[model samples]
Target: MKNAIEISHLTKSYGKNRGVIDVTLNIKEGDIFGFLGPNGAGKSTTIRSILGFLKFDSGNIKVLGMDSVKDHVNILKNVGYMPSEAWFYNSMKVAEAIKYAADVRGLDCGEEAEKLCKRLKLDTNKRIKELSLGNRKKVSIVCAMQHKPKLFIFDEPTSGLDPLIQKKFFELINEYVSDGATCLLSTHVLSEVNKYCKNAAIMREGRLALLDSPDIDDDTFLKFYYDEEDL
Candidate 1:
């Protein structure tokens, strides 16, 4: 099968500190891949790089079969992204924000967006500033998934969600995966990875520490973090 996401020796530096260094991994088509790491471990850095938000100092990244740097706009058309932080124009209503996102993507997402809002119980009439953190996240989720893109990229997507809502979010993800969509879920939660991911990669200090199947037990999971790679 063709790879959905491929990275090789990806390095990005911020002066004295490294953003990501020599990180290499491949996410196969139709796979739910977990990008696991602790805070400041370059998980977001790698993600941002893949999304073409930040230019890396070296190495290469490919989305689907295209070079990420050169084909970012095209890549984005087929990808749904939920950033680590959700932000919107404070003055816009929830519905307005959703519409604006759809307009920018040049896709009509009215029906799916409305369905998602109802399922997540989001108040579309409320102004962005009036919503709680979790509610805002709900809006972001709808905007990201409305178009039914081929690939999904979620960064700490369930941060402020309540348990029930988190379950709903996972259900939506499962539905997407069931339809053969690929996903890259970046989070610190091990249970989330173990439950959803077919394969997983652990990042430490801007480098890849391990890449393996997610079917391992708790003891094996802990051991990967301690294992060192030559890269």
Candidate 2:
């Protein structure tokens, strides 16, 4: 088994503000890894660093056997990212937005986009500004999955989505993983972690609080969250 993502002694700070501190982790290819953390716990910070969107203070991050910074563009080509808050050109239609995402990867994703849109119940004819939060999330899902990238980095991906759509989304992810893709799922939904994740990590105060299987007991999590020393 190969590691799809590797981080060693990774640290990042936002001036005097807090960020991730000496975080280290590895996810094997084809694994569905869950990232759990309260708001402001640095889950997004660590993810941003992995995508080379933020400059870290020290340490190294490798994705797909390549340096995160030096191979940023190449890494992007194989990554399918769906942010919690998907941003789009308000003036463009949803179909156009998906096309723009496909263009960025230099791939023709028409067939996949259509399939995902149908499964997600997304309206391709709607303008970006006309869509609600859930609709926007659906658009993001289409954009991310259309190209069928090797790796998925989803940050709070299920937010704003209805129960049916959320179920469909996970089904699609399962299909992707079965095809040998890897995923990094960052979210606050513990139920999802328990159901879909093989391995999980929790963060607190910009530091790792626990690293274990997703089937963590409630008491154990409560103890760990109250104070890292308790764990």
Candidate 3:
């Protein structure tokens, strides 16, 4: 199968600190690829490189069969990205932010965005800075999904969301995949991976420690990591 994302010998560093080290991975088209790592394990760095938001010290990255750096603008047009941090103009209303994002993506925000806000129980009229963390997350999701891009890149997408909203997000993701859209999800939630991802890559200490199908049990997988450390 053709890959939606490909990284070959990718490396990045911050001064002397390693951000990523000789990393390589492939996420096939139409697959929901889970990226699991503890905080500061270079998952975000790698994602940024894939999106051409960050430049690597070495190696190559391809997204959707195009050079990551050279084709970023074109690729971004077909990709929906939800960053780890949700940012908005402090004075802008939630509805206004959603509308701006949808417009930038060349999408109509009239019906779909409104329906998503209603389903998430989000108050569209509230200013961004006035909303709670969970509500901010809802606004982000509503905006991200409004355009229905071909590939969705979610960085810690469910953070600050309530359980009910998280469940709804999962349903939305599955619905997208069922319609043949691809997804690359970066998260630490192993349970979510077990329930949703078909395959995953686990990053440890700036490198990929494991990459395989998600059918394996967490206990067994955890044991594998422990054994690797001679524990």
Candidate 4:
């Protein structure tokens, strides 16, 4: 089977500043891969490169067997992405924003969207600008998962969610993976990775520092980050 994601000697730079350097990794199909790192470690940069959100200086990226840069449109067709920060049209209602997205994707997501809203305790009638940060995150989650895309990419997806809702979110992700989908989770929270991920990668200074099963304890993982800087 082909890998879900592959990167080789990937490098991205901003003039004198480095974004990521020679980063290489593989995420197999049907696997939930955890991307772990301290702040400013380049995790988000790497993700943006994979999503073709920015142009890289060198190297190659493939998602679901398609070139990330050359075939991004089709690649995104099978992907659901949740950014670290959730932003929506401030003037629209939660339901309206979600429905618009689902319609664009050509997915009949009304039933599933409603179920997810209930699970996350989101008020669909609320205006996007009126919702709290946590509620906005909930709306983003529903929009991302409602279409049941084959690949899920979440960047700190649980940031403002309460514990109860976080648990439900993980349950939903597990259910998605059980059906043979793939996931790439980038988070600062180690326990979330330990609870759901099968394999993990640690990034530092825009480079891959470690890649292994996340069986190690949280303290051990923290030890890998000697610097206290936030990425």
Candidate 5:
């Protein structure tokens, strides 16, 4: 199968000694890939680089067979992204924000947007400033999934979500995957990795610490998880 994402010695620095270092990995098409890392471990840095939000110092990144930097606009056309923190025009209604996202992509969302909003229990008429943290996250989810893009990149997607909503969120993910989509879930939750991901990569201190399948025995995976933590 063709790779969905390819990072070759990807490096991004932030003066002094901060940022990702020599990261390389390949995520296959239609795979639910997990990116496990603690906060400040460069997971977001790598993701931002992939989305062309940050310029890397060296190395290369390819998404869906297109150069991340040179073809970022094209790549985005097929990718859905939910940031760890949701930020929208606080003065606008939730529906307006969702509409704006669809308008930018120039794709009619149709009933898909309404279906997601209903499942997530997000009130579209509510002003963005009135929603709670969880509700705001629900809005983000709808905006990200409404287009039903080929690839979905969710950074810490479950935070602020309740257990019930989280379950529904993953269900929606599975639903999308069955339609031949790919997902890259960036999170620190090991259980989520074990339950949802086929392959997983762990990051530490701005570098790749381990890359393995989560379907491995729990004992073996825990050993690797702790070993990396002790480093």
Candidate 6:
């Protein structure tokens, strides 16, 4: 299968602090690739680099056959991204924020957005700042999915969502994947990964500790990683 994302010899640092080191991975087109790691393990760093948000010390990153830095504008047009942090104009209502995102993405999916809002049980009239963390997350998901981009990149996507909502989110993801969309998901939620991801990369200390298909249960996967002290 053709690759949707490719990283080779990727390295990044924050002055003296290492963000990522010699990271390399390939995600096939139409694959749900899970990126798993403990805190500070460079998952977000790598994602940002791939999105051209942060400059790396050295490496190559390509998305959809285009260099990330040089082709960022074009790449972004075909990509849908949801960051780890959900940011919005504090005073804007949820519906307004979703509209703003849709406008920016050149999407006119008011009906789809409304359906998602109803399905997620999100109150569209509440100001962003007034919403709880989970509500904010729901808004982000709605915005990201409304555009229907070919590639979806989500960082810690389910952090503040309830279990029921999380399940709904996964179902939505599967729906997208079934339509031949690709995803690169970074999260600490092993259960979600086990359920949705076909392949996963486990990162530790800015490097890959393991990369494998989801052939084992989450508990066994956790035990395997725990047994490996350095990871």
Superposed on all Cα atoms, the candidates' RMSDs to the truth, in angstroms, are: 2.8, 1.7, 2.1, 2.2, 2.1, 2.1
Order by TM-score, highest first: 2, 4, 5, 1, 6, 3
State residue 53's C-alpha deviation in candidate 1, in Å. Answer: 0.8
Q: Can you list the residue pairs that collide in candidate 3?
A: none
Task: Please provide, for model 6 over 24-112, each residue's C-alpha lDDT reduced to its tens digit, 9 standing for 90 to 100.
Answer: 89999999988888788899999999999898999999998899999998899888888888888998999999999888877797998
Over 4 Å off in model 5, which ranges?
Answer: 215-231
lDDT of 4 at 124: 96
TM-score of every model?
Answer: 0.93, 0.96, 0.92, 0.95, 0.94, 0.92
Model 5 steric clash pairs: none
- In order of listing, the candidates' clash counts read 0, 0, 0, 3, 0, 0
Model 4 TM: 0.95
Predict model 6's lDDT versus the native.
0.88
Model 1 lDDT tens row, 87-182: 999999999999999999998999999999999999999999998889999999998899998899999999999999999999999999889889
Per TM-score, the best of the predicted structures is: 2
Candidate 5 lDDT, tens digit per residue, 80-188?
Answer: 9999999899999999999999999998895899999989888899999999888899999998999999899999999999999999999999999889899999986
RMSD of 2: 1.7
Residue 202 of model 4 has an lDDT of 92
lDDT of 2 by residue, 39-147 (tens): 8989999999999989999999999999999999999999999998988999999999999999878899999999999999898999999999999999998988899
**Index of the highest-lDDT prediction:** 2
Predictions in order: lDDT: 0.89, 0.92, 0.85, 0.90, 0.90, 0.88
Name model 4 segments beyond 4 Å from true: 228-231
